[model samples]
Target chain A: EPEVTQTPSHQVTQMGQEVILRCVPISNHLYFYWYRQILGQKVEFLVSFYNNEISEKSEIFDDQFSVERPDGSNFTLKIRSTKLEDSAMYFCASTGTDQETQYFGPGTRLLVL
Target chain B: QKEVEQDPGPLSVPEGAIVSLNCTYSNSAFQYFMWYRQYSRKGPELLMYTYSSGNKEDGRFTAQVDKSSKYISLFIRDSQPSDSATYLCAMGGSSGNQFYFGTGTSLTVIP
Candidate 1:
């Protein structure tokens, strides 16, 4: 079965440096999303993307965060400047038109030191 | 208050025991409910999906939703050691693709 895939399973970056996390959602899916989980915390929604534009975003998605569907298959999340609190496991998810179920990738663990 | 709430349990059970996981939500607009399983340091994997209020069973797992009470549950029958993981409950409204997730419950099935 097809599944969402993400690159750079693990990343370590210096504080204030930029980091771009990449994801390739299922080919036929129309909606994509990003979520993050801090250690010992619940999964938090970041943003949702559809039709090349942001459909919805949570307060956690602030000025430093941006998402792009640069190509038909690639969806990227860029953090302009990372903070120590930014360290967390970032997950990418996608769903078909039904929009009921979301498939998630293995996740990229980001560490901003 | 948080949109969704769950007891973060480090519940341990013997192999072959049944496991029950649950979540409650404050949002009445949520129509889609899901349960996901995640191993340590890994992303969540979809386990069960239900719409509105009802019950759904797949393999040895069962999911129950009570929209009136704003509660949901996932039950694992004849659990095994492989069932050890954190279970998260997620719900979304019909308006968009955004989903609200529970804090997750950790379970350990010792063989």
Candidate 2:
């Protein structure tokens, strides 16, 4: 079965440094999303992408965060400057259509010091 | 109020026992309900997806949605030790492209 895949299973960065998380969604999926979960907290949606552009974003998706479908298969989330609060597990997901069940990748754990 | 609320249970059960997990939501417009299972240090894996209000069954897993009461549930019968994981309930609506998730309930099935 086709599955979403994310690179760099774990990353550690210093404060004020930049980090980019990458994901390769299922080949036939049309919608991609980024979500994050702070330790002991619920998973929160950050942004949704479709048709090569952002379809929607949450308040947590602020100026420091950006997402891009850099190519046919790669989707990325770049955090300009990492902070202690930015430490969390970031998940990438994809769906064949909007409002459908999404498939999630194993997730990239980011730890900022 | 939070859009979706779930009890964060570290619920433990013996093998072959039945397990029930539940969640409630404040959004009346939510029409899509889903359950996901996540192992420690892993992203959530979709286990069941239901549209509107009804019961959906897949093997030993059953999902129930009550839109009027803003509630949903996942039931696992003849549960095995491998079924131990964190269960999360998520709801989505037409107005939003994102799904609001509940704090997951952790389960441990002892053999």
Candidate 3:
């Protein structure tokens, strides 16, 4: 089955540095999303992208976070400046249609020290 | 109150046991319910999906949704050691694409 795939399975970055987590959602998917889970915490929604624009973003998706579908298959989340609390597993998901079940990628584990 | 609530269980069971996992939500608008399985340090894998208040079964797994009570459940039958994982409940509505997730229940099935 086709699945969402993410690059840089694990990343270590210094606080105040920048990091870009990349995902290649299923080719035919129209909606893409980013979510994060802190260690021992629930997954938190970050943002959703459709039509190459952000559809909705949560409060945690503040100034430092941005998402881009620079190409047809690539969806990326960039943290302009990382913080220690930013350490978590970032996941990318996609659904083929509105209200369809989303399929998730293996995730990119981000650790900022 | 949290949008979703799930018991963070470290529940242990013997192989062949039936495991029931559940979640409750405060949002009445939620129309889409899903159950995901996650191994430690990995992303969630979709296990079940339900559109509204109903029951859906896939192979040995069954999913139940009670929208009136705002509750959902995932049942695993004849569990195996490979079934050991953290199960998360997620839901969303037509209003937007964002989903609310539970803290996840950890289960261990011993063979």
Candidate 4:
């Protein structure tokens, strides 16, 4: 079956540096999302993207966060400046239609020091 | 209060035992319910999906949703060691594409 895939399975960056987490959602998917999980916490929604625009975002998706669908298949989350608290497992998900099942990628583990 | 509530259990059971996992939500607008499984250091994999109220079964796994009570459940029959993982319940509504997830319940099926 086709699945969402992310690059840089794990990343280590300085506290103030910028980081970009990349995802290639299923080719035919129209909606994309980003979610994060702090080590042992519940998965938290970050943002949702559709039609090259943001559809919804959570409080955690503040000024530092931005999402882009620079190409047909690539969906990326960029953090302008990383904070220690920003370290978490970031997952990219995509769904073919509204209210459809969302498929998740393996996730990118971001570690800030 | 948390929008979705779930037990973060490290529930351990022996092989062939049945496993029951559940989650409750405060949002009445949530119309779609789903269950996901995550292995250590990996992303979540979709296990079951349900719309509104009713039961959905896929092989040995069964998903039950009670919209009136705002509760959902996932049951694993004859569980195996490979079933050891964290199970997360997620809910979504018609208004948006985002999903709210509960703290996952970790299960260990020892063979």
TM-scores, chain A, per candidate: 0.99, 0.97, 0.98, 0.98
Q: Tell me each candidate's i-RMS in Å.
A: 0.8, 1.4, 1.2, 1.1
Candidate 2 Cα misplacement greater than 4 A, ranges:
none
Candidate 2 C-alpha lDDT tens digits along A35-88: 999989999999999889999999999999999998899999999999999999
- Model 1 per-residue lDDT tens digits across residues A1-113: 99999989999999999999999999999999999999999999999999999999999999999999999999999999999999999999999999999999999999999
- C-alpha lDDT values of all predictions: 0.96, 0.94, 0.95, 0.94
| Candidate achieving higher lDDT, 3 or 4 | 3
Lowest lDDT 10-mer window, candidate 2 chain A?
A94-103
State in Å the error of residue A28, model 3. Answer: 0.2
**Candidate maximizing DockQ:** 1
Whose lDDT is greatest here? 1
Root-mean-square deviation of Cα positions for candidate 2 versus the true structure, in angstroms: 0.9
Candidate number with greatest TM-score = 1
Worst 10 residues of 4 chain A by lDDT: A94-103
- Listed models, DockQ each: 0.87, 0.76, 0.81, 0.83
* Weakest 10 consecutive residues of candidate 1 chain B by summed lDDT: B94-103
Query: For candidate 3, lDDT tens digit of each residue in B1-111?
Result: 999999999999999999999999999999999999999998899999999899999999999999999999999999999999999999999754999999999999999
Residue ranges of candidate 1 with Cα displaced over 4 Å: none
lDDT of 3 by residue, A3-113 (tens): 999999999999999999999999999999999999999999999999889999999999999999998889999999999999999999999876458899999999999
Task: State residue B34's C-alpha deviation in candidate 3, in Å.
Answer: 0.3
Please give the clash total of every predicted structure, in order. Answer: 0, 0, 0, 0
Where does candidate 4 stray beyond 4 Å?
none
